[model samples]
Target: MAQATPAKPFLLPAAIAATLVLCGLIAWMIESRAVILREGTEIVLQSEPIDPRDLLRGRYVVLGYPSQRIGGPLLDPLRAEIGEGETIDDATVYVTLRQGPDGYHEPVAVSLAEPDEGLFIRARATRVAHDMTWLFLDFGIGRFYTNEHRAPELERRMREGALTEIVVAVAPDGTAQIKALRQAGETIITEPLY
Candidate 1:
């Protein structure tokens, strides 16, 4: 009887193709964020430390910005488009910020359309309240990373009401990235795009 040889499967080729696709996707994501950090328009926004009870025990600082909660007449224009029973529900929103005499950025308007001029950051509205007066949105720029040992001191300073703000770079397409963390008008940590 002749010995039979098993045919080779094509799994190897398929895996290689899949890996290439995955690498391409990862590269695209990295480059997109890098562009925002490297060449995007830079703006400064004020933030305060919140709930040190949790931050002191963690490795990162939880900073809250006034611009985060945009309400009142500011929601009027965007609210007009929302229909009955409609919720913001993770919707991408554009928030326009203008530089103040204090040199800090403040939200002037919110819209579904991307603004052609001025600085704007793209945010995802996580939840829309029933009255639509206020919505919890994620700017993707939260959660500044820090060393475990440094977390305590940073959290303490912020808790003690130290003046700290974040520098953000906003891309033309509305994407924004955190560029640096500033305290007392000085940069403490400069984040890398990559």
Candidate 2:
């Protein structure tokens, strides 16, 4: 009987090592999804979707804050709210919100008459996910989210009695992100006025 040539010894061990690496990778990936990031609050801002060509992260969903919701521009709120001799200059006006119908914060912009007269919520300016310097609230992927516009309404909402909540999250680059003036303490029933 002819002796069979000995099979190469490297094949079996290589196969086993490859299998272990693949299995380890699969297990880690499955476990990682269970982790939650950003121990913080959620704020639902009126956002209109946008897609703009940028230097990076091409064609993404951008949310536009509802700047003009209830009041029309023709009815200058400044004229109605402020007295004579108040300069309509670019002032860092803080909005105070009052609970509107159905218990939503309706923002009323206040002219800070005296220095340090109002309560200001804390917020941070961050670089958007390894792209531009534009800052936004980092909600979990595929969940409720908002942009810089959220800040104004949130401040206004608080002015309308909607209290802002602090949110912190880790970005893709491991940077801690934060948002301020987000209505987090109260449970908001997101609904249309009509």
Candidate 3:
């Protein structure tokens, strides 16, 4: 007698689709909480949000004028040279000569080429279907809280029309920090995680 032929098992396409969907969901969740960490020296700095594309090594935000916290003469002659077309060198650029007792970020030495500043800055970038926009603020990483819920406090200050000042922290290597805003009589770097 002839032996009976074995039949092939059927595959379920629906189960495969479900597995793919689950994987996509997990990837999206993890990406939502990803943080980009940029660090510098121990100093508290404030930033004004702008387009992220506007920032780079050769091109940077000005410490004084337009939106200035420290009102005084240009501490460094180089400040005048940082126009739209001008290219900053690898050396440090000093904007403010001295810092107030409150220890706000005053302009000391600003270098257009490197992370010469003592404060680490932070921002958020979002991508659309065909374009990308970034929330560029001059504020340092110290300003942002790990828990985003506290962001209201930052908004409240802006709403209340609080007065702000700029100060500087000078490092031995000639790195200068330009802090745009800070609390009165408050110092930022008593302790830092980095």
| Of 1 and 3, the candidate ranking higher by TM-score | 1
Which candidate number has the best TM-score?
1
lDDT of each structure? 0.82, 0.36, 0.35
Error of 1 at 144 (Å): 1.1
Pairs clashing within candidate 1: none
TM-scores for candidates 1 onward, in order: 0.83, 0.29, 0.32
Off by over 4 Å in 3: 1-76, 79-86, 89-96, 100-145, 163-170, 174-182, 186-191
Q: In candidate 1, what are the lDDT values of residues 1-194, reduced to their tens digit?
A: 99988876888899999999999999999998888899999999888786433445467777777788888999888888775667777889999889999989988898888888877889998777778988777788777777778778878888887747888888888777888888878888898767
Q: Report each candidate's C-alpha RMSD, comma-separated, in the order given.
A: 3.2, 15.5, 12.8
Q: Write the per-residue lDDT of candidate 2 for residues 57-79, one digit (tens) a residue.
A: 33323333432222333225544
RMSD of 3: 12.8
Ranking of all candidate structures by their lDDT, best first: 1, 2, 3
**Candidate 1 overall lDDT versus native:** 0.82
Model 2 is weakest, by summed lDDT over 10 consecutive residues, at 125-134
Q: What local lDDT score does residue 13 receive in model 2, on the 0 to 100 scale?
A: 98
Candidate 3 lDDT over 22-140, as tens digits, reads 99998765443221111223343333432111222322223322222322343133335454334332223333233335444444433233344443222111111111111111322
